[model samples]
Target: MEQYKKDFIDFMVSSNALKFGSFTLKSGRQSPFFMNAGSYITGSQLEQLGIYYAHAIHDNFGDDYDVLFGPAYKGIPLSVATSIAYSKLFNKEIKYSADRKEEKDHGADKGSLLGYSIKDGDRVVIIEDVTTSGKSIEETYPKIKAQETTPGGIKIVGEIVSLNRMEKSADSDKSALDSITEKYGFPARAIVSMKDVIEYLYKPDGSGLITNDIKKQMDDYYAQWGAIM
Candidate 1:
């Protein structure tokens, strides 16, 4: 794992954003652990999160993409923070855009409200928090494709970098990044896996905030859901 990945997992475990317990996901399944990306609230924490994302982007997608398109809601801040980090760390000033749940009367009048106009044939990358059933990415990709001036014109890409990419049988385990990479050859990466995070927390000298019983409970809960990757 990368240094940032290790550091990020440790940070999240310490921050309590990566908690182990019975939690319900959008897929209507019980999860042993939960990664609440929205819990990263502080300015410094957001900056660090952006730094990690920028690292993942450079390592996976490199300089291939021209613009970063983050979907509505959770993706808004992710796009902004990541663009900022890319500009500062990599000296790459990539433009960022995002869609609104409801279309605005002004602006593009099409729905997107974050960045400026994305020209035809522009190489765009989609930014997201996590990949559950891939429903969100699937929905956003077509909307982006529709905005192109020419039919089958723009270079549409999906760059999904998340904290966890669970096994298919686990709760909300759909791997959008993996599927897209296999389908259209877009780059996919993650800071860390839930397994790695869990193992890290259990090591004798590892960074952990909870007790052994909590770890055991987490392990048992995860077992009920089956193997996780």
Candidate 2:
């Protein structure tokens, strides 16, 4: 793993964002591990989170993209913070945009989007905390595609999430990220995978966050719901 990924794993654990044990996901799966991006609450934590995201985005997508389109709610802050970090770290001023659940009826900035308005010919990269079922992308992808005033519309170069669960979706044998890629025709990637987490935290000497019992539980969980990827 890269140093940033290793650092991100440490950061997630230190921030209590990534937890191991019994947890029920929104999809109703009994998961051995869970990651909650909302745990990074402080200003410093968010700044660091943005930096990590910037690194992953730059690594995966490079500096070709013009805008970062984060979906509503959770993605709003993600887009904003990472744009700032990208500007600071790479010296590139990337615009950030996000959709609103309810469109504003009567304002200069009315309609669905906030921050930099996604325009025609703008190359966009979707940023999210994590995608478990690939449902949020379904909700926001059309909203983005609709923003194109020109013929070709906007180009979605790729998507970047914090982690890849590496588990199959409820409806498919492929992982959620994989499903998104196949459906949207853009690459969906993560800073780290569950495999990376295991390799990093589980050691032969029995140290690290993942213990023998926890590893066994994770193994069973994967056996039941692991993705084809």
Q: Top model by lDDT, which number?
A: 2
Error of 1 at 171 (Å): 12
lDDT per residue (tens digit) for residues 99-138 in model 2: 9888888879998899888888899999999998998888
Candidate 1: lDDT of 49? 83
lDDT agreement of model 1 with the native: 0.71
**How many pairs of residues collide in each model?**
0, 0
Minimum summed lDDT over a 10-residue window in model 2 is located at 203-212
User: Model 2, stretches more than 4 Å misplaced?
Assistant: none
Return the top candidate by TM-score: 2
